[model samples]
Target: MPKCMIDGKEVEFTAGENLVKVAKRAGVEIPVFCYHPGLSVVAQCRMCYVEVEKMPKLQTACSTMATEGMVVKTNSENVKKGRAGTMEFLLLNHPLDCPICDKAGECDLQDNSYGYGSAYMRGSEERRTYVDVNMGPVIQKNMNRCIHCTRCIRFGDEIAGIHEMVAIKRGNDIDITTIDGKTLQTEYAGNYSDICPTGSLTLKDFRFKKRAWMLKKTTTVCEGCSKGCNMEIQHEGDVIYRCVPLENLDVNRYWMCDEGRFNYQHTQDPTRIIEPKVKAEGGWKTISWEDGILGIKEEIDGQKPTFLVGSDLTQEELTHIKEYIALQHPGATIQHFGTPGLTSTQQDGALDQILRMKSKTSNLNGAEKLGIAPLMNDTIKADTVVVMSAGRAKLPKINAKRVIAVGVYLEGDASQFDMILPGLAFSEKDGTIVNHQGIEQKLKRAVLPRGKCKSLSEVLMLLTNKKARVGANP
Candidate 1:
């Protein structure tokens, strides 16, 4: 219960806590560029300067520890002038092309410049620029907007555990590049753009797609794996534009792996099977929702079934499937399948030293928690197999006489199934999923189900109740 005076207000902070956190409690703003809560505090940006009562000069709030009984002045003339000077210096060589930059609306450098910097320039010298290098397929580099904050450098070293990004030179000529201009090698490379205070690094997938201000954001969880890294899905016109990590200290912290970051791609894939289809004399024929349910009932009618639930499904969906099986198909066999070659949570381990897990599915632990056993190769003897999942789980090869797939899937994924009932993806449904650590997280609905896709619960209702209406939002 240590107390410190920030501005004029007494703020209590944990001993050894930095002034930035303490200032935040007292509603005092200390601008920072190099300091990320998840990364090491380098205090190199010098943008979060504050005037201490007994100290002669300003101190960097990001690195300064708050001592009990110490007074701080974040808005004093000395601190304001110090911050303005830092802003001016940072903007000295920064490109003034905010009109076209993708980071225009959300760029920290732009906001700081307008808030703390003087309107008139102190120097009319030529600005610095460098030829951009291709970091990789995930990131696009623009050295002209680089602020030399070293955030990406520190993130790669301290968090990612990969020392791939480095500064090649010193001072004004310093070029932040990979070793020998090699392409980015880390699987977490998408985070390079997320942690950048400026648009020096931007995601290639999100580049030029939409302005940062134009998209609507939905707080959600990543369905890529069991990590369940919190994320935000941004969209406009009911179309998802991008996904970014949401901070969860106990889980993903301030970062998400590239696999989870780009997992939204499949949801918006053009080749996805959006309409219900029934196999007939032809390869596959588009069928109405009513007819689709009728066809499924006819196929599974009077035949013993082996239900293969995808471990990628949320806990709510999994529980619903369990209840449905118990009530409707009492003698039917129900098992879970996901992440080929990986069955039980016992076989699941870290794919890397960091976030990636060996099991590709998000709810393998949840499925196990529900007393659902892993499906084995020998369990494919039933006359009909009903496969269900949101999307991340890969379908196992089925040799059953009749195969009924009831989940979001792509046309290319149609090779192993006989009938398809279009279902919602992770972003299109609201449910709960337990992660590898047994922490239950919520998967929020970002957009309505794309095309004719329906929720799994609704599909089950349609299958069970002849009176239930079947529609996209149902």
Candidate 2:
């Protein structure tokens, strides 16, 4: 351990820890452009300069290690002046096009300028400009707004292990661009949008769509696949703005697949089933929640009933449904269904391996929690079957007299059921889902379910003999 004084306050930190890390630990934020916790220390920005005792000049706090008895002044007049000057120099070549930029509201440069930089520009020379390069289909690059942080270039090489991007030239002419004008094609390429401090890098899909401040952010786990990557969903008035990685070290670790990031739009798609329906002589007819449950119970009472559980439902919903079935029919058989596989990643390791798990949602954990035993292949005989949610691969082939489909999506060849119970999507319901790592997270109701659609919990309460409690936290 090494003891150091920051802004006249005594503090102790790990011996080999950088001064910037120690300062952040002590509730001090050093303005930085190129510094990242996972990457190697470059200390190129010089924005984190701090005044130190016995030092001839200000030092880069990001790379400088604190020594015993070292006195560091992070908020000193000289240090603040140095940071303001450095920010000005960095902004000299910037385009100052925040009005039209996608990163305007949440940009680090916009925040740092308000904290440290002068209001007016000092230089009279024409701003340096560069042609915007076509990086890839997913990412748009605006070179003129770049601050030479090299975070993007480092991210491609270090985290993604793809050396597709690099810095070209030297001195005042230094710029980051890809060789042979190649596009950035990597599985983890989307992460650069978060790492980039300015509007230099932006997602092609989310460009000019919505301002960051206008969107409501909800922290939820990604259900695109079984990896259960931690994520934050940004939306406004039923429209999803964007999906970003929520850093959970035990889970996704600040990274989520591009598929998981953009797949949330399906939940709000127009084709999604929004109400409860029952199979009639004409076709599927919209019915009330009570009517739907009564129809299901009538079919179950008529013959042997089978229950098909989808992997997309949360653990709590799964547990409650299984419990309801057990209480109704003590020996009823339940079948499991999994969603089809999506695009897999090329990376290896526990983190990546976990991300590639084929069962996309946390429903497996839910089934386990409820102690609902899955029916084996030998136990396929049944007269009535109740299907829950989507994903029917785990379900056994049965010759049931009556089939009940309960889900938001009309999926698979098992749609010839007598009763169809329309369920709400994850975004249309309020419940908690447990990720693969056993971390519990809540999903809020983003929009009202269209038509006669109802949540699984609501339908279960109606069907079960036990009265469901209101405002229960799972």
Candidate 3:
């Protein structure tokens, strides 16, 4: 490791590490706008001004690589003046809409301006503004808030492998918009909101939703696919507001696909079955947990029910299901099902060069590791069928006389089921899932189980209990 001095403090750095990274490691903060670790550094913002001992002028820390015996001053008078000038220029056209902006608390511009910007303005001319362009469903375009960091533009070309977003003009009049003002054509469009320094690009799903500081964050992995991109579930009062990518350099880096980013919406959907329900003559009727457990037992009590375990389930949940099936129904056919037509790990691979995976479920490899075979031809061959899922895997076709669904389900998903035992979503459960790379990650519980939802362990306990405590107050 090479050594450097940042603000009079000695610091160690690896070869080729930038000053912005090395300075931060030494507890010295260098403000930045266009210096996302995951993206290429352009030094376009010119905000990370640092004074090198021998250099004549201030240098942008993002593009300045640290070298042996290099001495960098981050908070000198000249550096502060340079950074303050840069901050003033950036805030020249940026609207004072922090109160209404979705990126208020988390905006890098807000934090940098308060720390480095001048309180008074010198320019008397009218501030430049542009008509907001439509960037399609995932992102809301607000050109008025852009500072031309070009993070979104680089992300599209380098990360998403799509050159959709582009800068049409140069200098202060530059505008970052999709090509021909077209709708975004990338499956990873949600990342545009994550990498943007300001509120220029914000998530449409999170617009006007909740204040960033008000929501609690839960670090978890995406169960949407086998990629297992790390993400944070932002929620308030047990209600999820949004999901954002958490940087894991090994797995998802700093980006997550729109499918994983907006996947939490299904958990909070209005028609999701939160309470235990039994299919009646007229329609579905709400039942207590005790009754729901007994109802499931009644359906497949003496029969060898075929257990269709979803590969989306966590290793803990799937292991429990396998053990429960073995004790409850010996010699019963049990198979794991996720994406239809994609059975084994051999069929699971990268959907794109990016983070998306072909296997829609998170634990396809884990299921295969547990000795559970994939459902053959996506078909079931039994009189009684029990389907267990965490609501990520596609539901397989069932031709059985009695069908029981035990997991999260929406109203439309219950049409062919005899009974529904509500279970926790990935956001409400703590368990482990193995990714496509064979790296195991833990899913942290962000909220309590919604309504009458119970864990698979609890449901299994009730079914296996010899002392039939039926109708005994849920």
Candidate 4:
């Protein structure tokens, strides 16, 4: 461990930890543009300048190592002046287009300039211009807004193992571009949006939708696969604006896959079922929650119950459902259903606090916690089957006299069920979902569950007399 003074406060940090990391640990955030933890340090942006005792000049805090008895001043006038100078230089090439730029609210350059630079520009000459380059299908590049941070280039070459971007030319003509005019084709390509200090790299789907400040962020886990990537879903009211990676060092670091970032549109699609429907004589009709519960109870009381658990349900829901089922029918056979062996190799190496099973669905650990194992490679036969399909179109067919489908979406598979119970979607309810690594992440209600749709716990309470309400602590 190396002890150093950051912003006049003495603190100890792990050996080899950069000054920026040490400063952040000591509650001082050094404004950075080119620094990334997972990628190689280029020290190009020069925004994280700090004054150190006995040093001739200010140093880049990101690349400087914390040493024992080192005295660093981050907020002193000298350091502030150097940062202000750097901000001014960075803005020299940047266009004053915050109003129309997609990265307006969340732009680091805009924020840093307001914090450390002059309100007015000193340059009277026309700003330099460059042609916009098509970086990739997932990323668009406007080199004019770029500060030449090289975070994107470093990320492609180091983290993603793809050298798709590079700095070309020299001096005023220094620009980031691809070789042979090829697009940046990488699986983890969406991260450039986060690394971009300005509006240089913007998401095609989220651009111009809403300002960053206008969107509410909900911390949740990615359900794309078993690699439970910690995610923050940003939305306005019921509409999801975008999905960004929440920094969890043990989980998906500061990166998430492009699929995880863009797959949220399906959650708000019109095809989702928003209300409970019962298969009555008049086809499938929307039923009240009270009537729906009673109908399920009536059916369960007369036959052996089979609970079908989906991998998508959170661990908490899995716990409550499994416990309630055991208290109601101790001998009930619970079957786990999900797209098995459907692992994708686009691993984000981010450790999700949520325990990820070999099966990627969110509820596997919850089922295991309740002393119930997921259905293995064995066929299940039951008189009454409780099928919980989070979004899948079909479930493995087991010999069952009656099928009960509980989910938020309507598909052809639910049609086979005698009773269809609509459940809350990800945005509709408040719950905790564990990621692949067993990190329990909480998701608050972003939108009201449409119609009379209820959560899995609510539906279980109705099916049986067992108390099904879960506490917030879990």
Candidate 5:
């Protein structure tokens, strides 16, 4: 391996590794705006200017490739002056609304300005501003905060494969907007907010919500689909505010679709049933956990119930359910169901060239791996049916009169079920799920179980007249 000198430290380089990457390896910070690791290197920001030993002029570290015996000075006086000048120009038009901006704590522009910018302002003219256009439901556009970093434009072009965002004019008057001021068209539009250095682009779903630093982060995988894209659930006071993509080169890389990004809403939905309920003559009535367990046991006492297990459940939950059934009702018919028309892994393929999969549930592969058969024609023919899901899998058509649903359910779902045993959402429990690619990943608990919701293991134990054990590994 070849080595290069960066800020008086010798760092090994991988042939094509650039200065910014190499400098990072040596614990030296090289500030950048337009250089995202997943996106193309354009050096349009020129904020990473560094003094190369033999170079006549300062070079942008993002575009400069490191060679053997090459020396670079990242903290030189000339480098500091150059970076300060770049910061001055960037902050010239940027608004001083950091206190109200959603990107206040996490904005790269704010951090760079504080670290490398001049204390005094040079421009006396009125700051430039634009009449911000609506970017769509996923993103809020504020063209005034933009520093022409072009990260959002490049992301739409190179990563999302959509050339919707573009720069219309040249230089200082350049406007980064959709073609003809149109709304964003891609399904992965939330990522434009993620890669933007400034608050020029922000998530509409997360706007005016909790500040970035106030939210506690929990690293979890997306249950939106079988892609199992890694992400972080940001919550404060046990209330989830947003979901952002976590970098995992093997899975979703640096991006997640909008469906997955906003998927956390269902868990905290006001209409979601959080208490155990039993159907009476007039309507549904909330019941205690003990009564709910007794009701389930009495409902399936002598009947051979068909278990329609949802592929959205974790591998641990599925295994526990299978074991519980084998011990209690040995001959009960068990089947797995997820996306309609897509039963087996063979039918599960890429929905697009990007992260989405044909299987809408995260654990479709795990359910199949547990030796469970797919439900035929999306129909259950037994006299009694037990439908279990984590709310991601689509509900199947039931031919049975006696229906007991276990897991997250909405108020409208009450008509379809005779009894509902409230269970944890994916965010409220920690367990493993397998993607369509057979890669198993863990879903970390981000919040406590809603209301009287219990794990499937605990519910199953109570059904068998055994003491419920919480957090027991399958």
Candidate 6:
């Protein structure tokens, strides 16, 4: 085991690991602005200074490697002075509008200034300001507050594989903007606001909606694609404000595509069929929970049934659905449906070199693991079809005279269904989903189900033949 001394403490670290990582392991803090572990290190901000025992000058912790027996002083007076100076320069042009800023509570600039900077005013010149430009639909830019860290630029090149962000001028007069103010062109563009150290970049979807500290944070996994990027759902009183990527080194790393970041909105949509409905002459008519339960049972009891489970469902839900069908409808066939074109794990490949996956559903691999075959058009022998999903999986066209729809669905999507039973969305259920790499991750319940929505087990229990089935037989 290789070791290094950071802040007078001996710490074991991997060979070639940087000082910032080593110091963090040793419980020593090295302030940084431009360094992201996922992106290449540029060390432009120069905020993470540490005094090496034999070195003449302070070294940037983010760029310096901890060699064997190397001694570093992160808390030395010299290192403290260097950091204070760096903070002063970075804050000289920064607008002191934290009260109005969306990133106020979680802003790194504010935290570093309070912990490692001088309080007294050192400059008398007018503060720098710029007319903010639109980055895209997902990001809002406040260039007046940028510290020129160039993290967004590096993230675009190294991680996103796109070079949309760039710095125009050098030094103090520099401006970070896109080419000719064009809109962002990447599907993973939501990550720019996540990587920016300052309030210079923030989510346009989340801006001014709620303060950072006001929201309750729930750690969850994204279902936007097969990537299953870990994320945190921030909300106030069960109203989700935004979704930010949680670091999972083997999964989505520190980035999530824009599709997953905004996927929560569909769950809270006003047009979603959140309650039980029975089809009528013109359209769907809202029905009671007991009636909806009995309606589904009456419609499919005498017919040959095929259960079409969405691949987007978690493994727990899928298992429950499978067992219920096997026990109640003994000979019912169960087939999985997801992205229309992507049926099996073999067809599920990377949509791009980055995080975008060809399989739009999160649990496609999980379905394959469970030996569920993909739904094919020619295999439709059942008179009644039961389509179940968490609202993300696309429905396969079925030629059945009777179709029972369950799970989340938009009004237009359930127009032709014989019966609709409102079910929980991904955000409202607790279960497990396996990613494209076969890594199983948990999906935590972030918010309670809206209206009459119920869990899969509860919904399926209605078809049982005993007293356990919906209060003793309809």
Ordered from best to worst lDDT, the candidate numbers read 5, 3, 1, 6, 4, 2
- Model number with the top lDDT: 5
Candidate 1 C-alpha lDDT tens digits along 272-378? 89999877786879999888888888877566688999999988999888888777788788899888888888888888877888888889999999999888653
- Flag clash pairs in model 6: none
Q: Each model's C-alpha lDDT?
A: 0.87, 0.73, 0.88, 0.74, 0.89, 0.85
- Give me the overall lDDT of model 3: 0.88
Error of 6 at 345 (Å): 0.3
| Candidate 2, 206-290: lDDT as tens digits | 9988998899987777766656777788888867878898887777777887877777766666665555676677666777666
- For 309-394, candidate 6 gives per-residue lDDT tens digits of 98999998888887877777777788998887777888888888888798889999999888888886534546788888888888
In model 1, the worst 10-residue window by lDDT is: 465-474
* 1-474: candidate 4 lDDT, tens digit per residue: 669998789899988999999999899999998888877888988899999899999999999999999999999999999999999899988898999999998889889998999987798778889887677678878888988988888888776778888889988888888876788788788898888778999888788888888998887767665566778888887678888888878867888878667767766767566666777886778876666667777777745587777766776777787787667778777766665443221222333232233454554544455555556544567778877756631366667778777654453434667778777666666677655455666656666665556677766766765433322211
RMSD to native for every prediction?
1.4, 4.3, 1.8, 4.5, 2.1, 2.2
The parts of candidate 2 lying over 4 Å away from their true place are 279-284, 339-356, 373-382, 390-401, 407-418, 430-434, 438-452, 465-474
Model 3: per-residue lDDT, tens digit, 263-372? Answer: 99888787889888888989989998778877777777777888888899999998998888888899999998989899988988889999899999999999999999
Let me know the TM-score candidate 1 reaches against the reference structure: 0.97
Clashes (candidate 4) = 18
User: Which residue pairs show backbone clashes in model 3?
Assistant: none
lDDT (C-alpha) at residue 78 in model 1? 88
lDDT of 5: 0.89
TM-score per prediction, in order, is 0.97, 0.86, 0.97, 0.86, 0.97, 0.96
Model 4 global lDDT (CA atoms, 0 to 1): 0.74
Q: Which of the predicted structures, 4 or 5, would earn the higher TM-score when compared with the native?
A: 5
Q: Weakest 10 consecutive residues, lDDT, candidate 2?
A: 340-349
